[model samples]
Target: MKLLTTNTLMVLLILISGYGYIASCTHDDIVPPAQANPTPVITRGENVHLPNATGVADGDTTKWKLDKAHSSVLWSTAYVGAAGLLTGRFNQFGMHDVTNAKMLKYPTPSRGQVLPDTSWAFYENDPSKIYFNGYVQMNTSNTGEPGRDSGCILGTGYYNTVKIIPGYQNLEINNLAKIKTTKVEFDPLSNDYIVTFDFIWQGSLASPLTQSIVGRLKYIPKAAVKDAVTGNVLYSVFGLQLNFQFDCRDFGVTSTSVADVIDIECNMNFNNK
Candidate 1:
């Protein structure tokens, strides 16, 4: 009877130990509830607005000079009945002389002239206050191909027959092109300047042809830079990017392979004089 009681107690102890071990294993296998990620915070920089032209001091004569090294004029034309575009640029071009009395004039409200309140960003609201005259040497036209470039200057072969005049030995003199801005209007919706300019080009025609073109001008205003050590203002720079399209046929190019429509982009940079 003593041996039987001892064996029964030992069996009860083993069963209780086995149950405790199984409960611990089951508790370790349980996973915690999933957690959601936190929301991210975004910060934006301050917005810088363009300066108002009317705010300039009265009689302020600030002249801007063209930075030729940073300026470029690019043109492209699609081939007639072809799938490629021919891109080229004039190697020589420059901004015409601008005077303070002509280019940068103050507003005259007493003369019944009113300036737009919101449209006075770059220049005075009056289109007459801003003037831009530029010239291009058409003889400097470069298309990367020596043969095609020569044809463009001499106006022969693939290009239309637009040779220089008989007496003019210099091709550059006869092939000169000029552009002068006539009007400038700001479009608030598109943030672009509607510019009307006259494009003057001399082809094989007896006289230079004039075509009035309307182009979209994008103005990029830059802040003035200062010397790091002296803290003195150095210079201020701005940019004007003009884009337009015109029919080349108007300039007397009658080539069948050359497309009539030509796209032009002029990225011009200017610095305060």
Candidate 2:
């Protein structure tokens, strides 16, 4: 019952104010939990009927041109002792037809028009018909950091001299990494394709290394877009999702801080020409 001291009264008032502030906070004022990354959507071949190769010939000459705008080539590597991955991508690359001595090209659909249905043909059942020469521009390596990208091209620092392999140092060289498909086989169980190719890194310094990689090739014969009022198809879309890993040592990369294993994901889109 004794009168509270001035300091004690002030302390009590502070406590009451703190309690009132806490009581006034509602659910709306509380921060929500962080959200996990959303799963990517598969829009290339969503909900389309796959065509059968019943009448398709064994050596059909139909050509599917690559849609470079819709394609991507991403690479990642873990730091020697780090927990996360360092990812980057190539801004320039293309599929080539060595037999034709030219790069593959696709026709761009007009703003209001779409490619005809006959343009696209599926060759999954006949794997032999699926083949291409792939190339990557070494200078186009991008990691969102201009300095790091330049370092990657020069094979310096954490890149560990792996960016431009030996014998490819000539200024006149094309500065390209090439891939020539030697064989293609369809795996029914996984509904994917196993591709064996010569991954040519060094122009003449080393022999072509053979690597067998598996990739999912999704083909949608129908157009991805439709007319709002007429329901007419716009343009057909298809793509290959390829993920592979390789040791840097295999390509002469020997840095200790840089992980020996490098992962690559190439998402290639193609449109019927």
Candidate 3:
């Protein structure tokens, strides 16, 4: 009886070993339940490419210069005691310094492009690489009406308390530390950057109004121009258009008749000098 039990145990062991060898041989042919459909991981990073329609690379680190000739600041509010809207624009306003107005070309994948397969968080936590000091000369505002323009200028100054100071009436935007580079979206079709930054409205007697302004800065490529006589490339141009809206009450512009909300639009295109 003991001999018979021992033989039964050996037969069971041999069967188990044969099954293991068969499984190993057909490992590639069989699919496990867990691996039948695997989960996908998404990675984010700058996509570098050659100069395309925008004449810039995907991960281009080039610092673009702000073109002042093609730029302007426009704003509109409800007409004081009227039904129509009152729109005005600043004729003399630009990057605090064109020479130093630097922007990075961090291209992102969009328009049905494939996402990276690896994990990368470099841009997500990266600080702002660009700093610009933008200002609007309140005195250069034009609304077509001389009297109305003067009144609007006085009202704007009264709120900000800009005396003989020329550039004191300012619109400062410098917040490098707050920009989340990782989430910055790049539109490949039209070089537009969806960005958000701190906009410091230094006006009125109340205090400097600091608001996080979110908007898109579009880089419009213009037709290439060549020298008339030399037949050589004279210069190239691009347009930077910005549109945004905000509340006047937030900046202390409590005009008796003007509406609380204000609409702003701008266009700027210049050369790289």
Tens digit of lDDT per residue, candidate 1, span 114-146?
Answer: 221122124534444555666655655678887
Instruction: Tell me, by lDDT, which candidate is best.
Output: 1
Looking at candidate 1, the ten consecutive residues that score lowest on lDDT are 112-121
Off by over 4 Å in 3: 1-67, 97-131, 153-156, 163-184, 187-191, 228-231
lDDT per residue as tens, model 2, 1-273: 345687788899999999888877865498888998575332222232222232122233233455666789888888667897777887656554222232222233333112111222235567676665666655557788776665542233332223444322211123456666667776554556676666656422344344554444444343455678998865556666666666667666665656877787777666543
C-alpha local distance difference test of each model: 0.61, 0.54, 0.49
Model 1 bad stretches (over 4 Å): 1-62, 97-128, 152-173, 225-234
Would you list the clashing residue pairs of candidate 3?
A: 67-270, 70-268, 70-269, 71-267, 71-268, 123-182, 124-182, 159-204, 160-204
TM-score of each: 0.58, 0.57, 0.52
After superposition, candidate 2 runs with Cα above 4 Å error? 1-63, 97-122, 152-174, 203-223
The candidates, ranked best first by lDDT, are 1, 2, 3
Model 2: which ten-residue window has the lowest total lDDT?
112-121
After the best TM-score superposition of candidate 3, give how far the Cα of residue 223 lies from its true spot, in angstroms. 3.6
Q: Let me know the TM-score candidate 3 reaches against the reference structure.
A: 0.52
Better of 2 and 3 by lDDT: 2
